[model samples]
Each structure stands twice: as structure tokens, then as C-alpha cells.
Target: MKICVVGGGLSGLVSALELAGTHQVDLFERKPVPGGCLGSYRIGDYWIEEYYHHCFAGDAALLDLFDALQVADRLVWLRGSTGYYVDGTIHPLTTPTEILRYPHLTLMEKARLGLLTLRSRRFDVQALDGITAKDFILDNLGSGVYSSFFEPLLKSKFGDRAGEVSAAWLISRIAIRSDRGAGGERLGYLKGGFRHFVARLEEEATRRGASIVPDTPVEEIRREGDGWVVDGKSYDAVVSTLPPQVTADLAGLDIARIPYQAPPA
Candidate 1:
């Protein structure tokens, strides 16, 4: 099978690598360089990613991939701190005492918030799918918690459309990050940067007979008989790893009214 994987990010490269042995793969990237959000810069003696990134202990596939790429030795465990800045003061809220000292939420409210965090893993998030996080906070935990606590978070994470963000997404996010320690959350990072992983993945995929085309964006796609036409080239199938809105625009589909498809924060 001939496959055209779009976006040439980690997902696209990995997908192409996984299929290259049995299929003809052509990976296309819009940017001059690949890695998508995982791009990096050379800082002093080493490289660092442009965006903040870390792996969780629960990320088995990522660990396996790192090991397979022979970059496992570079993976290091680090404590990721959580804190807030208020009135020019930085408050680290990792420990129990710091949380208790936070003047915004009362003891009861803080307890309830912790309970919500604990229950997130078991919560029927689908029930809150259509409900906004703002409404969910106001209804379940009351206005004090919403205005004092979650409001800033929602605003910072979702900006102007924070009120329209679904409760399910917030709950699922909390659940996924539930693993914690006394200092902070334990996160994995490569000693240099994740760009090494991207580089290795690209190398392996190309070595396996996949063609990676950088600086070539698939602006157009159409179904052509049994195959698909991406740009002006035809292939058996196309895999798009770009954001939903971008993908929709490429395919000439309208999703403007879809709130979930709103641009990332």
C-alpha cells in the first residue's frame, strides 16, 4: 500500500516508521523542519525544546519508543513543580501546608477540590461532556471555588472561550495527571531534549524506505477513485496529524461552529 502521512510530526513519523517495512510511505511536513510542536533550539552546549514537554510514568509507549531508539539512557526523571503567582509572590502549592495556606479557598473548599481531583479517575466524564467547566464548578463546588480557584485556571488554559470549555476535558486532564509526590509530579525528560527522539525516528523511518518530504504542506486532498489525491500526488491513503480545524480546511470542510475544534491555548 502507498500511504501519504501528513504533518511529519512525531505521530506522522512514527506512523510512517511503523508502516514503512510493508508499505510505501511518503511523509510530508509543512515546516522547513519537522517535530511540529516538539521543535527545539540549540542552547549553549545542548538542545532544548521550544515548548515545555515531559513524559509521565504511565506513558509506556513513549518509554518503549525511547528504548527502541537507543536514547533511553538520556531519559531522566524530574520533579515538576506546581505553583501560582499572587500579588508579586510566588506560591508553591505542591505540599499540603502550601495548599492550606492559600487564602483563596477555605479548608472545606480545598478539601472538596482535592476530593474532586481524587474522584476524577472514576468520574463519569461523559455526563459532563456538554456542560461547561464554569457551570460544573459553580454547580458542584459553588461560586467561591470557581471564582477563587478554577476561574483563573480556565481563563489561562482556554482564554476567552474558557466558559465554553467542557467539564469532561478538565476532569480527564486532572485524572491523567493524578500521579504525584511530596515535592511535585514525577516527569520524564531526555537529558538533552526530545528532538533526539524525533531525529532518531526520522532516521529509522527513512532507513526503512520511507520518503520524508519537509517543507511540503498538503493544502489539498480529494478522494480519487480507489485512492486519494493529496496536493497533486495520488496515494492509496492519507493520514493527517494536523489540528482538526486545519485538517478540515484542507479537505474543504466547515467546522466553524464546533466549539471543541477551537484553536489550542
Candidate 2:
């Protein structure tokens, strides 16, 4: 069967790879560069992520993906320290000693904050679904802690929409980054760049007879008779990783409205 996967991000590339050997697969990417947010920038002699990203020690699936692409040797674990800029002062928050030395919050508040960060993963996320992060922080750690610390983090991450963010989402984010060492958090990065992994995935998929088309935006898709019509070409099936609104617009279908927060600029 002929298959077409839309939006040439990691998901699209992986899908095309899985089906490449068994069927005819054609992947489409709208951008000139195909890695999406995982794409890299070459600075002088090195390549780094356009945006910043690091993998945690608990990232089993990500490690598995690296191994599958035969680039496991490039994986490097590095200590990444974190800091907070409060009231024109840079406060390094990596070490427990640093958090203790900070005078913004009382000893009790600091203890409460540490406890909250540690318990983030074990908390019942459903209970926090409807509650705003602002409310959650204020209720659990008091106004002093919220106003002095977490509020700044929320504002930096979500800007004006921080008040609308659910406690569940915020806590889940905290949980994902909980792998901390004495000095800082241990994060995994590829020695060269993640672009090597992307290139390998693309190369393997192509070697298995998949066609990856770049700079092609799938603007139209219609279910006509039995099969699907994709950008004037006929395909037996379709898989799309584009946003709901975008896919809905392309297929001329009415989809249920979902509350989506605009990303930080």
C-alpha cells in the first residue's frame, strides 16, 4: 500500500521508517530543514541545538532511540547547573547549600519548596487538573514562597498566560526534570549534535525505500471514494503529526476545539 506521512519531525520520520520496508512510504516536510525544533545550528566548528534541550537519566525511550539509530556512542552525560535571576541578582540554585543561603524565603519555606519538588512525581495529577498553578503554589507553600519564587518561574515560562496554566502541567514538568545530583542535574547530550541522529534516521529510512520530500507542505487532503487524495497525488493511507487545527483545515473537517496556550515568544 502507498502511505504518506505529513510533517517531517521525529514522529513522521519514525513512522515512515517502520513502514518503509513493507510498503511504499512518502514523508513530507514543509520546512527547508526537517528536524523541526530538534534541528541544529552550526557555530564555527560545532553544532548545537537552535533551542536548548537536555535528556534526563530516566529518559529510557530516548536512549533506546539513540541506540536504534546506531549513534549510541555519541551520547554524553554532563552536569547542568540551574540558576534564578531575582531582583537584579543571579542566584545559583543548583546546590542544596545555595538554596539554603538564599534569603528570599525563610528556612521553613525553603524546606517546603524542596519537599514539593521531591514529591512532584508522586502527587496525584488528576487532583490538580483544574487548579491553576498560581493557586496550587500559593495554597501548598504559602504566598511568600509563591510570590518570591515559583511566580517568577511561571511568568518566565508562560508570560501572561501563567495564570491559566493547570497545576498538573506545571507539576508534571517539574517531575520530568527531577534527576538531580549534588552539584546539579545530570543531563544527556550527543557529543557532536542531535543532527547526526536525525540524519541517520533519515538515511536508514531512505535506504529502506522511503521517499522523504523536503520543503513540501501538505496543504490539501480529501477522502474521495475509497482512498485518500493528498496534494493531487493518490495514497492508500495517511498519517499526520501536524497540529489539530492545521490538519482539520487541510482535510476540510470540523474538529472539536481544544484549549491551547500560546507558546512563549
Candidate 3:
């Protein structure tokens, strides 16, 4: 089978590498380089991530992928601190003592917040799907804690439209968080930068007989007799991993029902 993969982000690159040996793979990337969000730019002396990302211990798939690429040894675990800016003060919020001493909430409110956090860690996210996060917090922790603490945090993180966020996101966040180790929290980063991993993936794909074309965008996609045509080039199968809006335009599909929010950059 001949497969044409559009986009060269992490997902597209991984998919291409996985299929290169079994099929004739052609990867088309509109950008000059791969890595997508994981891509980095050179700073004064070191490369920096364009966006913030920290891997949790439970990210087994990502860890395994890094190991398979022979870059596992480069992964580093770092402990960091967190602060809460409340009532004209930046309070350290890393430990239980800090939580208890937080002046933004009363003692009862703090206890309620603690219980809510514990419950959030254990609760099944699927069961809370139909409920919004704001509603769930208010119901479980009372309006006081919700309004005084979590609400402002959510707004700062997700913008003014934070109420539209799904409870499932919060549930997953808490669940992953509850698994953190005793020495504060640990996050992984590559030794040099993620570009090393990206280079390895591209090399492996090419060595396995895959063709990668950068700066080539698929302007259109249409169904032919049995395969699909991408900008008039025919292929047995087409895998599009672009944004939904771009995918809709390329496939000539309606975009009326899809709802998406842009993440803060």
C-alpha cells in the first residue's frame, strides 16, 4: 500500500515511521521543519521550547517512544516550585503546609478544597463528562472556594471562556497530579533539545524507504476511483493530520459542527 501522510507534526512523523517499513510512505510537511509544538528555537546559548510542556511519570507511551529512539538517557527530571498570587501576595503553594497557611481561603474552605482535590484524583472522569468543571467544583467544594480560588485560576489558564472547558480535562489533570512523587514534582526534557529526537525519527523513516517532503502543502484532497488524489497526485490512501478546519477545507467538507478553542501561546 502507498500511504501519503499530510503534516509533519509529532503524530504525523510517528505514523510515517511506523508505516514506512510496511508500505510506501510519503510525508508532506508544509513547514520548513518538523516537531510542530515540540520544535525549538535557539536562544542566546541554548534551545528553548516555543510552548511550555512538562511530562508526567504516567506518560508511558511518550517514555517508551523516547526509549525506543535511544534518547531515554537524555531525559532529565527537575523539581520546580509553584506560587499562587492572591489578595496582592504571591504565596508558595507547593506543599500541604502552604495549602493550610493560604490566607485566600478560610480553614474550612481549605479543608473543603483538600477534600475536593482528593476526590478529583479518585473520581472517574467519564462519570463527570456531562457536567462542566465550574459546576462540578461549585457542587463539590461550595461556591466560596470555587469562586475565590479555582475560578480565578481557571480564568488565568484558559482565558475568560474558562467555564466552557470540560470537566474531563480537570479530572485527568488531577489524576496525573495525584501520582506525583514525594520530592515535589518531576518533569522530563531532552539533553540537547527535542530536535534530536525529530532528527532521529526522520533518519529512521528515510532509512526505511520513506520519502519526506518539507514545505509542500496539500491544497486539495478528493476521492477518485479507489484511492485519493492530493493536489492531483494520486495515492492508495490519504491520512490527514492537519487542523480540523484545514482538513474540512481540503476535503471539501462542512465545518459547521466542529467546536475548537485555540490554546494560549
Candidate 4:
């Protein structure tokens, strides 16, 4: 089988690696490099990630991949702090004492927020698909918590579309970071940069017979009788790791709108 994997981010690279041994695979990347969002920049003698990237203790798949690449030993656990800035003051909210000192929420409101955080892991996130994050926070945690706490965080990430973001996204995000201690959440990072991970993935996939085409953005995809045509090349199947709207645009298909926000400047 011949497979066309679009967007040589981690997902596309890993997919090609998984399929290359048994099938002819071609992975396309728009950038000169294959890391996609995980791409890094050269700083004198070192590579630094374009964005701050970290993992959780619960990231099993990522851990397994690190093990497979013989780099699991590079995983480092660190305590990360959280905070809020209001007016001109920076309020650190990592520890219980810090949270208690926050001026915006009442003691009762803080208790309610704590309770919700404790119970967030048990939430049926799928049931929240239809509800907005704004509504979810307002209903369960009260308007004070929503406005004083979560709204700013949401707005920071999603901008004007924050209100339209789903409760499932909010709940699942909370659940994943529920492993917290007095200092902060336990987060993982590679000893060096994640560029090593990307390099290993690309090397292994190519060794297994995958052809990686960098500096190539998929321009067109269309059905041709039984199989598919991607960029005028015939393939038994096409797998796109690009965003849904982008894939829909290239494939010329209609899909329900899914809101996305670009990275903060």
C-alpha cells in the first residue's frame, strides 16, 4: 500500500514510522523542518523550542515514545508554578496559602473552586460537549470565579473565542493537571530540547522506508474513482495531521466549523 501522510508534525511523522515497514509512505511538511509547532530555533550552539513545551507524568504515550527512542532517561520532572496578575500585582496561586490570599474571590467562592477542582477528574467530559466553558464556569464555580479566575486564562489562550470554547476542553484540561502539590504541578521535559525527539522520529521513519518531503505544503486533494489523489500523486489512502478546517479546505469538503486560536504573540 502507498500512503500519503500530510503535515510532518509529530503525528504525521509517527504515523509514517508506524506504517513505513509495511507500506510505502510519503510525509509532507510545510516548513523546512518537520517539527511543526514543536520546531525549534538555533541559538549559537543550542536548539531552543519555539514555544515552551512540557509533558505530564500521565503522558504515557509520549513516555513510551521516549523509551522507544532510547531517550526516556532524559526525562526530567520539575515543579511548575501558576499565578495571576491583577491590576499591577502578580499573585502567585500555586500553593494553598497563595490561593487563599487571592483578593478577587471570597473564602466561600475559593472553597467551591477547590471542590470543583477535586471533583473535576470524575466529570463526564463528553456530556459537556454542548456547553461552553464560560457557561460551565459560571454555573458551577459562580460568576466571580469565572470572571476573576478562569476568564482571564481563557481569554489569554482563546482571545475573543474563549466564551465559545467547550466545557469538555476546560474540564479535560483541569483533569490532566489535577496532579498538584504544595509547590505546583509536576511537569516533564527532556534533558535537552525536544528537537532530539523530532530528529529521532524522522530518522527512524526514513530508515523504515518513509520518504519525508520537507518544504512542501499539500496543495490539493481529491477523489479519483476508488483511491485518492494528493498533490496529483495517487495514494491508496491519505492521512492528514493538519487542522480540520485546513484539511477540509484542501480536500474541498464541507465540515462543521471548529474554532481555533493562533498562538499568543
Best by lDDT: 4
Each candidate: RMSD: 2.4, 2.4, 2.3, 1.6
Report how far off residue 115 is in candidate 4 (Å).
Answer: 1.0
By summed lDDT, the worst window of 10 consecutive residues in model 1 runs over 256-265
How many Å off is the CA of 64 in candidate 4? 1.2
Model 3: per-residue lDDT, tens digit, 175-263? 77755444555667778877778888888888898899988878998889999888888899988887788788898878664456554
lDDT of 4 by residue, 90-189 (tens): 8998877788899989999999988988999999999999999999989988899999999999998887888899999998898888778777789899
lDDT, model 3: 0.81
lDDT of 2 by residue, 97-188 (tens): 88888889999999998999899989999999999999999899999998888888888887888788899998988888766757777889
TM-score of model 3 (CA atoms) = 0.89
Off by over 4 Å in 2: 42-48, 259-265
Provide the lDDT at 92 for model 2. Answer: 89
Per-residue alpha-carbon lDDT of candidate 1 for residues 39-122, written as tens digits (9 for 90 to 100)? 777768877787888989878898999999899999999877778877787778776677778887888899988898889899
Name the regions of candidate 1 deviating beyond 4 angstroms.
43-45, 253-265
How many clashes (backbone N, Cα, C below 3 Å) per candidate? Answer: 0, 0, 0, 0
lDDT of 1 at 52: 87
Q: Which 10-residue window of candidate 4 scores lowest in summed lDDT?
A: 256-265
- What residue pairs clash in candidate 3, if any at all? none
Task: Note the Cα lDDT for every prediction shown.
Answer: 0.85, 0.85, 0.81, 0.89
Task: Predict model 1's lDDT versus the native.
Answer: 0.85
